[model samples]
Target: MRKFVLAAASSALLLSVSTQPVKADDDLLRLAISLCDFAKTDDRSSMRRKLKAAGMRLRAIYPAIKCGADGSLLRVATVNNAFEAAKFLASKAGDEAINAPEEDGKTLIQWTEGLVAAGDASKQQFVELYKSKM
Candidate 1:
């Protein structure tokens, strides 16, 4: 009976340990999706608050967050016309995030130009911000 109990405990411990990474990944995705929501809603303050609470820097995690189809948080804000969020995200961007190509293989500036040509000229300021970083 003692051996059986030990074996059962060991198996349970191993199973829990093996599932830990998946839980962390899920938490990461959940946080990213919440940030995406804040951007889409133009809620820069809430985004800032959450980032502060999590001790995550936007410049550091910008490329990793996966905000939307565009992948960049700034782009997601821009597409949604969340100007405050777009500007806030843009200002926090490091050069790598600013220059990183979207899924379509175009840099943010190049992508924004297409958006502007298609009549999203309002996002010109974001393009300018990216250019300043470059």
Candidate 2:
């Protein structure tokens, strides 16, 4: 009975350890959802508060948090025409994010150029923000 108890305890410990990452992923997902909503609504204050409360920077969590169909937070801001949120996100962007190709397999600059070429110059402010970060 004692050995069985020990085995059970060990199994419980292992199970808890294994689930840690899942919990972290869940938390990140929730954060991403909230961030996406804020970006979509152009609520820069809420976005700032959320990240501040979580003690995280946009750049640090950028790679881990996919902003729904828009892909990255920057893109979400872009699509929603949330210049304030876009500027905030860009200001906090990391080199990897600035340099990394977006979900459509093109660098941010390329994507912006394409959009401008298509007569969508609305994201020009975001481009300027990210350019400074770069």
Candidate 3:
């Protein structure tokens, strides 16, 4: 009888644990998206908070750093839909261009230098954040 009860309790615990949502990383990614969206819309305070919550790091000088780059990988940017995907990712991921692997063995910074030169405000905010550590 005791053995049966122990097995039942273990099963219940396992079932409960399995049913819990497993999306810590997903949540962070979502938050990163939100931060980028907010930045595109000129919502700085909220965007900053969202980026902070996601544990993102900014290594670039500003969103303009990559704003003009081909943004094909991010469908939102491909459409020129007002969403700065690179800026958002950089703010949260800490200079994806710095280490983002690619076919030409190029960093995100090198690939997006043209865009960065265009003076992206959203990316500039990230640089500020990186500097402030906020």
Candidate 4:
């Protein structure tokens, strides 16, 4: 019947639309994390511009930190030694970000401490940032 055909067509259109992945923001977030490791070769200004154009909040939490667990953007930035990205998120999210804990109840400061113990003393700046906020 004509009605049945129309209904099926509409359903297929809706399914396709819904299944399309909106990946701009996700790509930006991943790039932001990667920038931390390649800071010398990366352009922080360009990254920020792209993220802003996509309407992605610098402080938005990405849920990929711990296998579906939620974590602030700051957490990811700090974990990867992305100083600029972490500082930007710290300024935006403030105390909430400074004090955010992982699923294991470990705070950002604690994570930084662990990094320091492991010979990454540069993360000390992050620990100081969170401590100042506290």
- How much lDDT does each candidate structure score? 0.72, 0.70, 0.39, 0.54
lDDT tens readout by residue for model 4, 71-109? 445555666666776665566556765576766788778
- What TM-scores do the predictions have? 0.75, 0.76, 0.34, 0.53
Runs in model 3 deviating more than 4 A are 1-19, 22-26, 52-97, 102-105, 114-134
Instruction: Give the CA lDDT, 0 to 100, for residue 66 in model 3.
Output: 25
Reference-based lDDT, residue 57, model 2: 76
Q: Per-prediction count of colliding residue pairs?
A: 0, 0, 9, 0
Give the local distance difference test score of model 4.
0.54
Give residue 133's lDDT in candidate 1 (0 to 100).
Answer: 69
Error of 3 at 22 (Å): 4.8
Give the higher-TM-score candidate: 3 or 4: 4
Ordered from best to worst lDDT, the candidate numbers read: 1, 2, 4, 3
- The TM-score of candidate 2 is 0.76
Regions more than 4 Å wrong, model 4? 1-43, 60-72
- The digit string of per-residue lDDT tens for model 2 on 12-123 reads 4334756585565455556767888888888999999998986667766676556645677777778788888877777777767777986689877677767777888776
**After TM-score superposition, what is the CA distance of residue 65 in candidate 1 from its true location, in Å?**
1.7
* TM-score-better candidate, 1 vs 4: 1
Alpha-carbon RMSD, each predicted model: 11.2, 10.6, 14.1, 11.4
Model 3: weakest 10-residue lDDT segment is 1-10
